[model samples]
Every structure is written in C-alpha cells, then in structure tokens.
Target: MDPINKEGTPKTPTVIFDADKGKVEIRGRSIPENSIEFYKPLVDWLDRYADEAKGNTEVNIQLEYFNTSSSKCILDVFKKLEAVHKKEGREVVINWYYEEDDEDMLEAGEDYQSILKIPFKMIEIQE
Candidate 1:
C-alpha cells in the first residue's frame, strides 16, 4: 500500500503502511471536516493488509486529538485489526502513543486496551 502523504493539514497526521515491513503508522490530529471520508480508505487498506500480513504486524497510532466521529472510526479500525488477530491468529502489536501531558489521550488508549485482546502498548511521546 502506498503511504498516505500529508496534505496541508498541519496538525493532521499521516499514515504509512509498509507491506514489506508489516507495519503501519498513523500520527496526527484526526478532527477532519469529514472524518469518515478520511478513515474509510484506511480501513480498506488495513483489511487488505490483514489478508496477507503474517508473522508480526504493528500498528502505531499517535494522535494528539480526534473528534467524536473520528473516535468511532478509530474504534472500528481497531475492531478490524482485532478480527485479523482472532481469525488469522497474526501476532499484532498496537502501540498507542500520546504526549506526556495528554492524560486524556492515554486514558482513551487504556479504555481501548480493556476492550481488545491484542497487545496494546501505551506509550508517552515527547512533544
């Protein structure tokens, strides 16, 4: 999959999916005007990747903030990943990174961790 290039949303994050490396990284503010429009393709990409991804798969998320719609979409993304893990039994690692002062974001990750079985690693990223 081609890496998602940043398109003028300074605070908005970019997405990189490395098929060869079995890694995907999403980092940015996800409060897009049309959240679904932004995330649908990501969901599609992940779905396709899950089909062939083997051994280890890592999805690293570093979002400073997101809207309610974006939150729902993010949950969907994780759910899809969870399905891949359960069905394919892929070794998946989710590293959720938040700023040191962003307790709210960290807590959000914690909440997601509680709901999913995949290894959710909460990390503090220095701004």
Candidate 2:
C-alpha cells in the first residue's frame, strides 16, 4: 500500500514496509487528532505482513513525540510483532531509535523492551 499523504501540513507519521531493505519504519510525530485513524491501517498492514513476513524484519520506530493513545497503539504494535516472532519464529528485530541524549525517549524504549521478549535494540542518533 502507498504511504498516507497529507499536503499543506506536516505529513502524518508513516509505517513503511521497505521491500528492498526488508525493513519497516514508523517515523514522525504521532499525536494526530485521531489516534485510531492514524494507526489503524498501519496496524492492519503489520498484521498482513507478519503472516507471510520474509527475512529479517526490522521494525524501526523513531518518533519525536506521541500522545498517550499513541503509546497504547505502540504497545499493540509491539504485541503484534511479539506474536509474529512466537508464531512463525521470524527474525524480528525492533530498533527503537531516538535522538542522542534524549533520556525520555531512551527510557520509553527501555520500558517497551522490558515488556517485549523480542531482541530490541535502542539506537541513539544525531537529531
């Protein structure tokens, strides 16, 4: 599916399944007006991809900020990944990237990582 596009305003965060790189990236601010609306299709896409998901599926989440609703949705997304890992035993890796020196973001990643059994890597990058 094509990435969701909105012009004349900031583009909504996107969850892109890159066929070439065999990776998925969810990047941007996620405090949309409707959290469900923003995340529904992406969740569905993850559900579909996880079924026949091929080789080293890397889920890259780099969000500058997200609301409480987005946090719940994020957990749901992680749960889905965990299920895929358990069910099919795929090489699922969750790379939670954040700006270097961003303690809040780093701590958030740690929180999720603790809950998920998948091999999660916290990546610190230049903002």
Candidate 3:
C-alpha cells in the first residue's frame, strides 16, 4: 500500500505511515481543527495494513503538544495498532519520545502506555 506522508502545519503534525517498511511516525503539534478528518486516512491505512502487516511494526510518536480533540484521535490510532498486535498477532512496538524537560509529554506517554496493551518505549530526548 502507498504510504501517507503529510507535512506538518501549525495546526497539524507530520505523519509518515509506511507499510512496506513496517514503520509509522507522527511528529510535531497536533491541534487540527477537525481531528477526525485529519486522522481518518491514517486510520483507514492501518485497517488495510493489518491485512498484510510486517513481522514487526515500529511506531514513533514525537509530539510537542496536542489538543483535547486530537487526544481521542491519537487513542483511536493506537487502538488500531493494538488490534494489529492482538487480533493479528503481529509484533508492534511504540516509541514515545518526549523532551527531557517536558513532564506533560512524558505523562501523556505513560497514560497511553497504561491504557494500551502494546509495548511502549519511553524515550527521553534532549530539548
């Protein structure tokens, strides 16, 4: 399947979903006016990717900030990944990168880790 490569604007994040490489990445701020609309294609791509998924899928999420609406959409994306791991029995690893001084981002990663069954690696990066 073709990958989704979206450039980040002030209101959105850069998204890179490459099924061939079994890698997905989202970086930058996510505060789109319509979160669902902005994230729908990615969700759909995941649905299709589940059919022909790789042995191991790596997800890298590096976000500086996200609004309330984007949070739910982010969770939805994770849920899709969870299904790939659980129902499909595919290996999925999430790398949640947060700046060293960003407590909120670290906590957000923790919260998602607590909620999702997939393994998450909390990576602390220099600001």
Candidate 4:
C-alpha cells in the first residue's frame, strides 16, 4: 500500500503512514475545520493496512494541540489500530509524545491508553 504523506498545516497535522516500514506518524496541531473529513482517508488507509500488516506496527503521535472534534477522530484512529492488534493478532505499539511541561497532553495519552488495549509508550520531549 502507498504511504499517506500529508504536509502539516496550521490547521492540521502531518501524516506519514508507511506501509513498507509498518510505521505511522502524526505530528503537529490538529484543529481542522472538518475533523472527520480530514481523518477519513487516514482511517481508511489503516483499514487497508490491517490486512497486510507486518509483525509490529508502530504509531507515533506527537500533537501539540488538538480540538474536541479532532480528539474523537484521534480515538477513531486508535480504535482501528486496536482492531488490527486484537483481531489480527498483530502487535501494535503507540508512542505518544508530549512536551515536557504539558500535563494535559500526557493525561490525554493516558486516557487513550486506558481506552485501548494496545501497548503505549509515553514519551516526553523537551520544548
């Protein structure tokens, strides 16, 4: 499957979904006007990737800030990955990165970890 490479804009995040490497990265702010529309293709890509997923898929999410709508879309993305990990029995690892002083972002990652069954690595980066 072709990689999903989207440049990050002020209103959206940069998405790099590399099927060959079995790695997906989403970085930057996600406050798009239409969150669902912005994330539909990504969700679809994950669905397709599920079928041909490799041994372990790594998802790195480093978002500085995101709106409420984007939060739900992010959850949807996680759910898709969760299915790929559970039903397909493929190992899915999520590396959730946040700035060193951002408590909210850290809590958000914890929340996602609680909601999903996949393994999560909380990474703290210096600003």
lDDT of 4: 0.94
Residue-pair clash count for candidate 2: 0
lDDT of 3 by residue, 41-123 (tens): 99999999888796789999999999999999999999999989885558999999999989999999999999999999999
Off by over 4 Å in 1: 1-8, 87-89
lDDT (Cα, tens digit) per residue for candidate 4, span 24-101: 999999999899999999999999988888778999999999999999999999998998888655889999999999
Model 4, position 56: C-alpha lDDT score: 80
TM-score of each: 0.87, 0.84, 0.96, 0.96
lDDT of each: 0.81, 0.76, 0.93, 0.94
Could you tell me the lDDT of residue 7 within candidate 3? 96
The number of residue pairs in model 1 that clash at the backbone is: 1
Query: In model 3, which regions exceed 4 Å deviation?
Result: 87-89
**Where does candidate 2 stray beyond 4 Å?**
1-11, 19-21
True-structure RMSD for candidate 4: 1.0
Candidate 1 lDDT tens digits, 15-120: 7777678787888888877788888987888788777776677989988788887888888889878877786567778999989999999999998899888889
Deviation in angstroms for 11 in model 1? 5.8
Q: Rank the candidates by TM-score, best first.
A: 4, 3, 1, 2
